[model samples]
Target: MARKKSPTLTEAELRLMEVLWQRGEATVAEVVEALPKRLALAYSTVLTTMRILEQKGYVRHTEEGRAYVYHPLIDRNQARRSAVQYVVSRFFNNSPELLMLNILENEAIDADELERLKAMIKNAQEDGSEQL
Candidate 1:
């Protein structure tokens, strides 16, 4: 059976969205150009991906001359939050603490980064807001 389409951005779609987020708006050709050299996606591929993003409500396009200039409907932070929530739901079993613990155990976090994380945790504790 065919897999269902996910609302979350795929890797290719995220790459395209990153270009749109950075540039504010861009044509398919421009997005193709902005992508990493190693990605080597064709203009047609970028075009199709942008259309998919539009259908997913992540982007919108306007007719600019002969080309469609696509703009991100969602901001970078919104995308990040959604992606994190999806990860927390799927792999972390709806437990953000498990996600944090997994990262802390496996990842090599430096002292400065650890301090920053601690500060953020402290702030969160002070606020007493567990609504994630």
Candidate 2:
């Protein structure tokens, strides 16, 4: 199988990956069941999406009786870090601090999150920060 290099997943694909990340492993029917009602996805839609993800090497399947159990091939944190890097590169002129600043300014981050953010920044500064 050919591995995709830095493939940007579609919204539906990301949603399926989200389910896989949350559940660790699930069947096609289980993924469809977990999808938000607003999506109005059919069972076939989930099945096809899972197959596509499997093809992309982001998801893998195992036989569990008659059903195929799917699990994420990548770690959740790594994907998030990849996505954050993608956004920073594509939208923020490859600057991570700008991305963090924009997020702090826009999103309704609560006090605890703000503290966590501060702690991260502090840790970064103390450790010479991560390279963008």
Candidate 3:
């Protein structure tokens, strides 16, 4: 049976997409080259993954000479937002607050980072009050 296409990018797909997002466009060889030596992804593996990304509508390709130059259809920020929404829906009962709370509780946040988060929350509350 055929596997269902995931709405969100897989880890492998995200790795390739990060390369595309950084470079703007690249051929399969370029992507393989850009990846860290630790990953050790083969040219064929990168090519196949790029094709999967195309099928998932996250990337498009143009034929340039003998190579197919692939470009990201979505930007990094858009992908991040989609990933966060997916996590919220799948693991937090669709509540972004729950997701935020989990991160605050489980992660070791620095004091400066915690202050920034509190400031952002304060700004959000002010914005909400202004809306009313």
- Clashes per candidate, residues 3 or more apart or on different chains: 0, 0, 0
What is candidate 3's lDDT per residue for 55-92, written digit by digit as tens? 98999999999999999999989998998899999999
**Model 3 alpha-carbon miss at residue 2, Å:** 3.8
Reference-based TM-score of each model:
0.87, 0.71, 0.89
Evaluated at residue 62, the lDDT of candidate 3 is 100
Q: Candidate 2 lDDT, tens digit per residue, 65-129?
A: 99999989997787777777888899999998798789888999999988998898799887884
lDDT of each: 0.91, 0.87, 0.95
**Decoy 1 TM-score against native:** 0.87
Candidate 1 local lDDT, 1-132, one digit each (tens): 987777688998999989998999999988988999997888888888888899899999999899899999999899889989999999999999999999999999999999999999999887886664
Off by over 4 Å in 3: none
Q: RMSD for each model, in Å, please?
A: 2.6, 4.8, 1.6
Where is model 3 poorest over a 10-residue stretch in terms of lDDT?
3-12
lDDT of 1 at 16: 91
Arranged by lDDT with the best first, the candidates are 3, 1, 2
Query: Judged by lDDT relative to the true structure, which candidate is superior, 2 or 3?
Result: 3
